[model samples]
Target: MPHNTIRTARCAALVGPYLAGKTTLLESLLFAAGAISRKGSVRDGNSVGDSAPEAKARKMSTEVNAASFEYLGERWSILDCPGSVELACESQNALMAADLAVVVAEAAPDKAVLLAPLFKFLDDRRIPHILFINKIDTLGDQSVRAVVSAYQEVSTRKLVLRAVPMREKGVVTGLVDLVSERAWRFNPHKPSNPVSLPDALKTDESEARQALLESIADFDDALLEKLLEDMAPDSDAVYDSLAQELANDQIVPVFFGSAENDNGVRRLLKALRHEGPEVAVTAARVDAPAQGAVAVQIVKTQIGSHAGKLSLARVWRGEVADGMILGGERVSGVFRLFGHEQTKIPTATAGDLVALGRLDKAATGDRLTDANGGKGNLGAPADWPERPAPVYGLALHAENRNDDVKLSSAIQKLTEEDPSLVLEQASDTGELVLWGQGDIHLRIAMDRLRGKFNVAVKGQAPQIPYQESIRKGTSHHARYKRQTGGHGQFADIQIDIRPLPRGSGIQFEDAVVGGSVPRQYIGSVEAGIRDAAARGPLGFPVVDFAVTLTGGQFHPVDSSDMAFKTAARQAIAEALPACEPVLLEPLLTVTIAVPSAFTPKIQRLVSGRRGQLMGFDARPGWPGWDEVKASLPQADMQDLIVELRSLSLGVGTYVWEFDRLQEAVGRAADRAVEIRREVLAAQ
Candidate 1:
């Protein structure tokens, strides 16, 4: 695809911190471009982008929403993405589909700090972007200037002023255009009426215009020569340089406006139409796909009411028809998504944001390409931000017993929509667990289960798998005899049990000599010993112990497998109590990365949670963060994450790997032993 061939001239994406009015801005743009008749607000629960029930309930965007509009003879495609840290990956995925990212910022200087991560992402990808200083009507001139300066201080690219706020009686009334040297005062109460710029902003307007021209002059030698000659540069030269620099991300033009009141929105739209990256130029893959084939990237996977699975894809090359093969399967249908509503379209071409219906095998970040019959590798661009590992988990089960099968299928669908969510069945404990980014992320996932899939579930904390082992060696004897029948049963055995090293698990050996016990019955005795060990004297699985059968006697005719098994079970049960059973708790090696300023607090938190700090290292790329490594009992880790998140303001991240199970002694171990013994006796 080429830039000149794109019907949609502009490809821009919106991103900012949570609740920064990104969706509202999109709504305003749509309304201005005539794509929508009336603008919808988030508070009213009627925004087009926030049509999902989960999004409406939370009043936040959980995924990317896209729409296109035409303004001033050029078509524009706009993508609105979630801003919450938990859903930040959605924004990254949107960026991959965008050529220019418009970072919306509030008037408050402190609020601008949240854009650091977004700026870093754009810079790393070498993606061009611009800044929109929004909500100027709410702040004074001095405050707005301070906020602008704060943004300039943080940004590596040149912050060029493309517009200046028109103030009237210490209030922002309109904006002065720096490029055209024109101004208009906005009537907030009556958006249809446009007031003239006040006389007092003349000097400020000139200064801003001069600064804008100087910033562009350095980019073109012709403009520099014209400036050296003390003459104004050609307007076309200035416009060309601005467009080229903005597209290349060398300069970020700041546009002043208030999205809520639609102040300067028209001017902003014109600037985007002129300065934004063309869809055809920007749609070229960051990394090209395989040749002689069409490839489309699925940026989002959304569940619909009656439409079922809708894959929001951007076609990079070629054309997709109703029945064209994608990923080796025929496409069911292609439709354009308008929230929950769908409009079927025939033959979507390159750079179209069309929804593919009934794409059961499609998922977010999947590349749908022409699949050749032969086995050949098709090189596709890597998906944006590899799926994040799930940090929090909950054990879940279907509330209705009959819904068990449906629950598994529903979970699979949810995972397909959001690949970051992880599902696992704990084979050791027979528990089903769902893992996600955080509490809210998991909550929304569960809500989707009941709301979208119509499957209800119950969730609870998983039981920590505990093990029991012996401490000291002990010997015992057992005998079994039956004389009620013609063929009587008789067996005698002596065994010794001892503790093994940690992680050694269970081991068995026999040293019986000279036909002390029949070899045929020895295997039966071992099976009986294992059955006894499955439920130790402490009511838990026994491990890290050795059992030896040193001597045994069996009658040739009377000794049966059952007789020897009973004798062996009785011998082990009798010997285990004398061995002084102890509890062994699973230990996890936990590593936490946090800012150094909070290192002391994190250390204290770990100690309070019964965790032993092993060591600490400085995080490589992060300046103030330190990685703290610790070993903590699995029982103590359940709620520790909640407290850790609270202390670190949700920035701290940690991962744990299972370590060896160790003997748990003292009061905790004693309590566990008592509980296990009570349970075993009851059983």
Candidate 2:
């Protein structure tokens, strides 16, 4: 898109930890912009952004919701994202679509630490942002400074004061504008009331002004020179430096207010209108391919009401109209997404965020472009963060037998919506497994499965897949003789079994003497040994073992392949018990990344789970967060994340990979072996 032609619809994403009032802030902004008549509280369940039934029940956003408001004649697209760490991916996706972010933090210093991961994410992405010190009505003046200092100590960027708390007898009434050097007071109970500048704030206002000037001077050489000469810098110079420093993400402009009470909301909106999107840096564009037509990038995807799939796209350089050809396919229609509602737009231009309806094949990272003679691969930038792998799994089965086909179809659609979800059929276990990031992520997927597609499924933790292997060498002999009136079948076989190295799998070798067993009979003996390996002495699939057909005898006319095979299988079964078999449980290489404060707790938890800590390393740019590497049994891994998240205050993150199956030969392993024996006997 041409720099001048592209409408600058810079977006600001409201994001924080759970219950931080992100949706409420959006509601406040919508009312402040006159987009709505009255503000709707989340408790009332009438908020525009949180219309989904799940969101209404939880009273929190579960996905990204956007609304556009015209402030100072400039279009600002505000995205309200979910705050729950379970839905952090939604916030990250919103951040990718936005040019800047507004991190809302509680006034309490302890609670303010929740913004650490988000701040690091924005810093790494180079997204400029402002800090809204919310819930000031609950904190005293001294507490507010303590919270500010706590944030400054943790944040790498300077936290410059853009607005100071307006006080009356030590009670915060409103905020004093530092740049404007004016006192503004608003009714804390009623946010829409016009704020009045109070004279009682004069002394504090002067100190705030000087603090703001000195902070700006630290960045601007000219302002520093003016400060040295004891001459105040021009207001334009101060604002210019503020804008430049904020745009470069060198400074995080801080404003104090209470979102719930609506105090300082109007001023915050005014500040955003003047300094937010208007000064946002444009996203870097990818150089267009020579022969391909204009391309549009799809940043988000939504399943709309009564609508199939909505591909939320931003046109980089193209005009899309109804029935227009794109990527050799016809553009069905372009529409704007208003919360959960969709409005059909006749045409969508470059830089406009629109929902392309009925794009079932389209995905979150897909690119739509005019095809050059029906041949070209125009796609969005592929350098974005890779989706997390699914480490947790659940076994799912449909309740109604008739809904089996429907269940399969629903699972496919659900997987499409969330690329992180992985579906697989266990070949050995013959069970359907749904894998996801964590327990909550998988539960949400299951909820969508039932709610969106009406596919009722029973979910449970999957059974641990265990293997049986031998520990010592043993030999046994078997003979099969059957009499059937005229002809008789007879065969004799001897087999030797031995344990192989871990993960070596099963191997069969024929070491029969020249005339002891026929060539055809030797093949049958090997097949029988392979079949016996399927269900070892413990009834679980055998692994990491080898078998050899040492010697066997076959009657020329009476002994057939079936006779030799049956005899060999019986011999191997007899040899397995004497071979001293053991059970092998799957081990997982679990890597947990958590705040340093919780390291000791995590180590203790790992120890309790019988895990071995391999090492610990620091996570780059994230102070007080350590990456802990450990190897844990797969069975112990269940619900381990729940404890970790609780310990780390939801900032904990982890990824696990399958290591190898090792012998589990203690009391627990014996119990598993006993259970397998009972199950096999019953079968």
Best TM-score among the predictions, by candidate number = 2
Task: Give a tens-digit lDDT track for model 1, residues 29-99.
Answer: 88777878888988888987877888999998877887765565555678898877677777887787777
Tens-digit lDDT track of model 2 for 296-399: 66667766435677777766555678877666566678886667777787877655667777766667766667777533346555545467666578889898
C-alpha RMSD values across all candidates: 4.1, 3.4
Global local distance difference test of model 1: 0.77
**Candidate with best lDDT:** 1
Work out the TM-score per prediction: 0.86, 0.91
